[model samples]
Target chain A: MIQQKIPGKPVTVTINGKKYRANEGEILLSVAIREKIEIPHLCFEASLDPYGACRLCMVEVVRKGKREMATSCTLRAADGLEVLTDTPEIEKHRSILFELYLAEAPKSDVIRDMAAHYGVTRTRFLKRIEQGDPLGNKCVLCGLCVRACSEIMGAGAINFINRGPYTVVNTPYYAPSRDCFGCGACVRVCPTNAIEMEDVGADRVMKSWSDTRVPLSQCECCGRYYAPRELSASVLARLDTPLKEEIARLCPECRGKQLAQNEILAGRGGRATHG
Target chain B: MDERTLDAIIARHDAPAGRLLGILGEIQNQEGYVPRETLELLSEKLGVRLSQLYGLATFYSYFTLRPVGDHVITVCMGTACHVKGAVAILEALEGLLGIKSDVTDDGKLSVTTIDRKFTVEIARCFGACSMAPVLRIDGNLYGYATPEDLPVILGEYGWTP
Candidate 1:
């Protein structure tokens, strides 16, 4: 783990033979990722918990005379821990995983791009490509979408059902989802375009490979759909109290225009009011 | 902390609208690091978004989510310091205390010791090129420090030989 922050006390850890100070308990992959260290991972997000499901961020850790290979995302940047990110052995192990990922989604840009980055031109392993959501989904199931919906958006609209390789993300009971707000929060967080959104009149439907559709709201001002009706209404209702009710009816761009107009007026004249 | 204490802490600030920095400083000063629970408490009490509060907390180097040690050890690794053997001096200190550098990890300025006794930190430069290879131990500046100067200096701070 590398320590970049120079705050109160800095702990030092070695990465690729160079000593770097890092914060205690920070994920090692984040250290490497931030420095453009080229540790391939799909399940890693700074905002979310360090889920080591990707298995791509493995690094050789030499700490206090013990050598072990550990997932960099789960590993803490403790002092005296020496991490070797790119070695022949580490790369060999990583290439196997990358190769497997490619076989899973040969058309997947995620695996293909990363494999290209790591120089994995081809995979000898036979493609046991399992079927996934439409648009050649290529969803590696990093769980970022599932976590984001429940955590960030506070909407437990979509989730993973079943176990093992048969597991797929879906709303409860694989139904059309009456509970879904059409927020498309899951779609926004999806690693792959497996979850897609389309506008149909006043409603915008977020579609997944499971054939589930979530309806959303169309922007009133621009006649463009932005969010689910419930979410939009809630946000507008909140803004109305402290802000102008007219601003609530307008979309973000219009609101920006209104603010910009106010700014220009204020700049041109003193105490300018839109009304 | 209890809600009453948190309420009093909020009361110390002029208002609940924009005293986030002041409130964070006060909380950090009182409790070694800002607790997430405290942040949630502040969010509820102050009506500030949790995300906004987190932005401020992580942006400022002074604010730490983790507890730091009593003594702060700062080494200069700026271009001038590097030419002056700052890396060697830092390595020597690391060898002495067994604290490694994690600069590649958090992009933070410092990393505290595991025992929480010391925080081994680094800075680019103190604007003192002449005094290259400088490091500070508990606010006291040591210029032109060599690998040989470590154990003896650390001994002065009651570091066991």
Candidate 2:
């Protein structure tokens, strides 16, 4: 087994004139938050991987006589670097970043809460049209769910397919599969709650995660929700036997009908069984 | 209240919650960030609480509550950009700016490393996959960016190393 290298000894870095020691590879934002620095962030959730999508943790770092903006969640602490957490300029850009998020997902309560904290009562851009008002629902497309699934769950079940404004996340060919364990992690991490799952039958359901809805179906014999409709069809089509018809006919109601017909053909099944 | 200032503040105060963000954007453009005093004036004029005003300002990413520099540099750290050494580019920028991603320099240059920006956030694939690593200064796209290219890019924006 390849041994993972342990981070170097902790080093002291000054943030907003307050000095703190941080271990190597531990993000500055996490360290600051641990120390109650209150660095604003949206996409850096401890439960999930740090995406740095919200751009709210932007901070000023002075190192080796050079200064630049760095994401606190992604930036590792370096010795002798001076950091400023709440400068006037940082507040201004953070306000703007929040405004952009509002433009992308205006109705989100999470965004509203963050904005309230920062004192932004207005924005300069056009208001985002509400869903069904030509603009549709507010999904900023942070891809948090997509990353969480692949990185943490080890299920490459969902991915972004298509391009530009029309892009959406889905399984390949817009079909559900056994690869999806129905964990619902995608639904949890979605910033906008755009993806929805609805129960269609016993252990069977439909997922409206994107534009195209995928219907998940259960196996009639085993009563197990095996795969989505599109996936089942594609798989059975490749099989030589009449598995597709067998699947359709294996339901309790269909099986009962078949049994009655078979008995009637033998002249031994009649009104008693029918009733 | 001066006629022009009152009108500007009143118009912002009277705007709808959704439209309020846009109005605030205009105010920032005019005054170089949402002034705290202007926020107070708006709160009183619009009959909104200061807390409500702060809520709105902090809710969106585009509205600035404080002053910003003359030029803004936004680096993309989207998935495509990340796989293409966007982190290294951001580190190089940090070295050049003497400040971190969301902080502006004393010289008035605001640098931000955004995962996504504008209406077209880095939420989805940027479709500039061919460009690999990309950065935007004032909404202009730069592809195949490198640490070596930082000076030239900053120089074009009147930023001297």
Candidate 3:
């Protein structure tokens, strides 16, 4: 009897005419990308589950003489699965899809980069007229920011509203959401850089996030600003016990230096006691 | 919707209609649309990601996160329907609602009105191309619907003018 998917085992997959070893059940998009195989994709985040929204990471899979198109992000890597990344058929569809995205946000640098990569000179589809700057990054509605907010940060502040051409990410009831923590996780994970968050010395302002502004934690060591105070406190408060939860108000670099100094002091103390 | 009711609906999944789709279908039936609270409850109960739940919710036209009016009116915007004056029908409905082609204040077409009386939405197709320019009010299909008939049709649902 043939064994199917031994748990906790690695598998070999053939990608772009090359053999590569991958963890069983790993997303094919990540495996392809990790192996240096370029498959132009959007709507994929390392912190979120495989969402088959963008459909740009399409790859032709040949299994036992049957060929089919599958979104690499949603499909898992399996043993003996032959994946062709850059076939003309796949490239053709990617160009058409990118054109649609270009038509939406023509001036977006990320979209332009993809267009340049695919050699898309112009879009065939008509762009929708919306009130905003053409050169500013626009939401392609890939939902990465939404996922990062919900899945990664547990902040379900924003979600998809409307459908079809009018679909967009907005706070609940189209108002400023109470769930946003000012952590900037959504801004950091946004693929198109459509979201912008700024740390203004002592306060953080996220314009796209319903004008969210929160206080920043200053590093005790050097007076440099670090994480958002509310976000840090919220995360620290989520610990199992409520016994005096405290977060060190220090920058990462300062924290690292302090940790090393303490280790050296502890080592010298132990040597003195032992000697 | 209460959390206990949602838990009960989730427990009622069977071979035919007990899966996520079936459970969501049941929720949609009870609430006229999928509520965010219900969605969050289901996500919490099932340990599923919110994005995945939202992806499924947005993928289907029947499932809506926003509240819907007592009566939902959908106009077919398919190619066949579009060519046969569906745009005019949608425009008329928008005029009546003071919104653009079923679009809500948030630019979303599926949102309910302030009073929750009527919700206007655009459908991809009803699969009845023969009856081009079709519209549906509360699941009842109307064929060859014209812009002039908007008031009379809405009047049937106790909507005056």
Candidate 4:
């Protein structure tokens, strides 16, 4: 069993006049959320590293007669620090951030959830034109896929490229990457349904977090979907050098069948005969 | 407007998180960094404490405690950039400037080393992946960079080789 580290020292902090003790170095937001303090957050995930990009976890912290607004995910507990999870200023900032995210990626359920919770339905900003969305704007630019790929999976198959306003995540050469493991971790972490799994009979097409099409494959045996076309081809190439026709003809099950038939024909037929 | 008026405006208006970041960003833009005094004033007017304010400021990578230089040099360390030897280029810059990421040179050139910048930050693939090892000085993008090109790029920016 993998050992999990329990915090050695516990620290005391006050939230809205209520005192709570938590482990040192633990994120203030996670502990507050666990304690049911109703701290608003949008870009934080327990499974992944804290990305303060969304700026939703802003809180008021009072320490030694000083007060300031900060993101709870990246801050640690300090002795005698007083925290306020909700205030008009914090609420206002969170609402506007949600609006900006909405203007960019209006169709995200995660954004919708935060909007509903925060009582934000409309704003003064004009509705942004859905630039890349074929169906509609869905991606919120949360960086989950990038973090999962680089930090968790250890395969830097994809990443954000370019600078402001025109940045995009892509493989090297804009061609299919050789490093992807077909894990679909990016697809799973997307906040917007912009990234989709398209099942095309024998193939699986993956839409990017921003709705760019990344064609994947469907296993022939169970018809389960896999990763991008280039990734699948590379994986198959590593195992054996099969002609395209041969590969197309054999799914996992059919390939197993071909191997069994070849074995039987090679005088390993005794097992078949017994059966 | 004076500090009192600025504090009054922050207190009177009910700004959301994005607007707050924008407001704080504006303050940073004006002052070159978010002053501790400004944060304290915001907290007192907004009824929040100092620790909470510091938490928000430190949480996002964009907010900086120290002053930055006039020009910002951001080197892309994304996978494509890395594969094409972005590390070497970054090392060259560090060697030349005697500074690291998030630090400005004594001459006031702020250099930030990031894997990705905003906008294209959420891109599934950088379309210019063909141009591996890219760098962006301010907003201008350069591609297919080598260690040899570093001196030329810096020299163009008035940095001697």
Candidate 5:
């Protein structure tokens, strides 16, 4: 008896005339990205859901004799879902989008390099450069950091404040966020590396969010401050069984060494001493 | 509103009409503005994020986060009203309140007096173009209002000083 290992009926999607196997209802952008197809995207994070705010991955879907443009990140895969990644219309759209991004985040080398890759080096739009911007004037306002913090970390520390043209992502009242776990999920998920975080002494300073400081946990063995205390505590709480008292206070590297030592000692039928 | 009153309001809205907007609207109507403490309490009680509530409060012009004055003076700044010296009326109210119109960092619209006696604001329109340069104080409309009519109209609302 043949069994399907993956969920969703296997469907082949044609991208740039090459057919690739994917599950039905899977994101088209995910399929294109997995198959090494050249589709430029910014706001798509594998951990978080597709937001489609960047509009960089616009692809043309052909059905019968008609064509429709849609964001590949939000587009779902189905059988015979023929799509062109770099059609003339998509190129024109990408060129204008790159120009807009260039103007929006002029200080970002990531944007400049990516734009130059697609042959868009100049923009006619007025450049926006705020003096002493905490995000280093590189934020494209893609909401990836905001969404990652709230959705992934359950922090909900930052969000889109104000409205319309004045909209910006930051802590409430632009004050130091009391709820930030200092998990660095936002810094990791930021497509343009707009979020700034640094561990200063005993506290992790979220410089972008009004210098929000979260306390760092000191390792028992190394006596070095490693992770945020709250974040470590939260992660420990999720385990089925709590770690041993001595092992819980050590950092990841030290903890791994201690666990391996304990395994060898247990095999030798001897009690292991806490290093 | 006190914490108890806020709890009661949330309890009342918690059942059939537990929508966040409706609950916030009720708070605005009762308290003139949604207080930060009240929003925090609402976030905890309703299991909604504080940022989400703050976003909603700031997005809508009807909801204000700061404490408003006892008497709210709203001058319409619609196209018809602006043509008829609406700016003059707003300036007059600012002068009467002894406070300059300052836009805060959060983009809040209304400006309240220092003593918290009065708040002057601008509205897009009241849809009463026949009464161009219209002003409303405590929900009472003054049609065809002038800068000169402010002191007298405010006097009626216990602004004798």
Candidate 6:
């Protein structure tokens, strides 16, 4: 009998002729990352579901003398699953993809560094640099930022507009969005740091999304503008018991101190009512 | 274009699966183009996000967001058509219409005349390669089209000069 640590049934999968343990139905890319395998992947955030948009983590899954190329990010782990991450065929495919990405995001330092690591110094594909590009020409159109904004933050502020050869992601109608929360989930999840955002005097401006501005809430105690007003209001609304008005207006650091002081006073006094 | 008509259309294809595309197609057929208001109404009725609807509309070339001209001149840009001098025919139309073929920021190639009487657009293929260098004007397909034939063709549409 084996001790089970993870929730699912333990399964062993082979990657590049080496056996590794994985939970059943776990994403092969997640398993590879946990084992310190150098399988490069983008558009895969742990919090969000794997969509396999980037096609970087191509692996050859061998089954009964048949080999099929599959994205490891979307491939589920199973018992006796064998995959080759660095075969000649996979290397060739990855090199072409790297070249395409190089052409796609010509100004991306991350893409340049990663492509260089794979010995792809130049691309044969025509380079496209949009004049006055809002994303600084670093975006690979991986849809990570778009997904993070919509799926995670529920903002739905931006999306991919147009079709093949002319495809680009931006706010609808290339206008400043009214639906954005200014939570910065998109910025945090972007693989290439393509989204440009700034805190410019009492407002958080999403510079890439047509300079959409979200108002910042000022802390009553310390006079520091911390988070977006709408985001903070929505978060505060989700709390089980409503916080005191005074404490709610304070920033996180000031609120923490106030809460601690209240806790001490509550312990010392018999009937100190703390909201 | 009204709420009642939109609601009726939605009701027709409001099945459990694959309703959005069907509803959108019907709207495109009836309205010639999918209006923003219709999309907003659909979003509210179907509980779909506006961004997703916009994405679907833009992804398919069949759906046009802007209102199309009274007469649409669609030139086939397929390999077969290109080999048959489609570029020359297209350039001739541009000169005749006084509208340069401009690619939008999102990469769609379309140009409408100032009068909005004619719109010149490029299609990947109309799937009629046998009749290479095909151009369709308002559902009338002109096969084996040459730059010389454009003036005579526009005459049929009541265009002068």
* Strongest candidate by lDDT: 6
TM-score of 4: 0.48
lDDT of 3 by residue, B24-77 (tens): 899999998888888878877887655556656775767777778889998899
Tens digit per residue, CA lDDT, model 5, B25-50: 99999989998888888888888888
Chain B TM, every candidate: 0.80, 0.73, 0.87, 0.68, 0.92, 0.94
Misplaced by over 4 Å in model 6 are A1-6, A16-18, A62-68, A242-247, A260-275, B2-5
The deviation in Å at residue A7 for candidate 4 is: 1.4
Give the per-residue lDDT of model 6 (tens digit) for B25-45: 999999878998898889889
Ranking by DockQ: 6, 5, 3, 4, 2, 1
- Leading candidate by TM-score: 6
**Tens digit of lDDT per residue, candidate 1, span A224-252?**
65556677676676564546465546667
Report the C-alpha displacement of residue A57, candidate 1, in angstroms. 0.5
Residue by residue across A1-275, what tens digits does model 4's lDDT show? Answer: 11126773888888889999887777888779878998766567677867787788899888767789989988777777688877787888888987787776666776777787788876566655545543256655667776777677765556654334434454432444444555677777766655565556544434442223445565566665544666556556766444454565456666677668767776744444222
Error of model 3, residue A160, in angstroms:
0.6
Better of 1 and 4 by TM-score: 1
- Give the runs in model 3 whose Cα sits over 4 Å from its true position: A1-7, A133-137, A238-247, A256-275, B1-161
Please provide, for model 2 over B20-139, each residue's C-alpha lDDT reduced to its tens digit, 9 standing for 90 to 100.
666566777677567877766765666544444554554455555545555656667678889989878877877876656442211122443232221112212456778979877766
Fraction of native contacts under 8 Å reproduced by each candidate: 0.00, 0.00, 0.11, 0.00, 0.57, 0.74
lDDT of 3 by residue, A87-117 (tens): 8999899999999988887657888888888
Pairs of residues at least 3 apart in sequence or in different chains that clash in candidate 6: none
Task: Write down the TM-score of every candidate.
Answer: 0.56, 0.44, 0.66, 0.48, 0.87, 0.89
- Regions of candidate 2 where Cα sits further than 4 Å from its true position: A1-7, A47-49, A64-66, A128-136, A170-179, A191-194, A197-201, A204-207, A210-275, B1-161
* RMSD of each candidate relative to the true structure: 22.2, 24.2, 6.6, 21.4, 3.9, 3.6
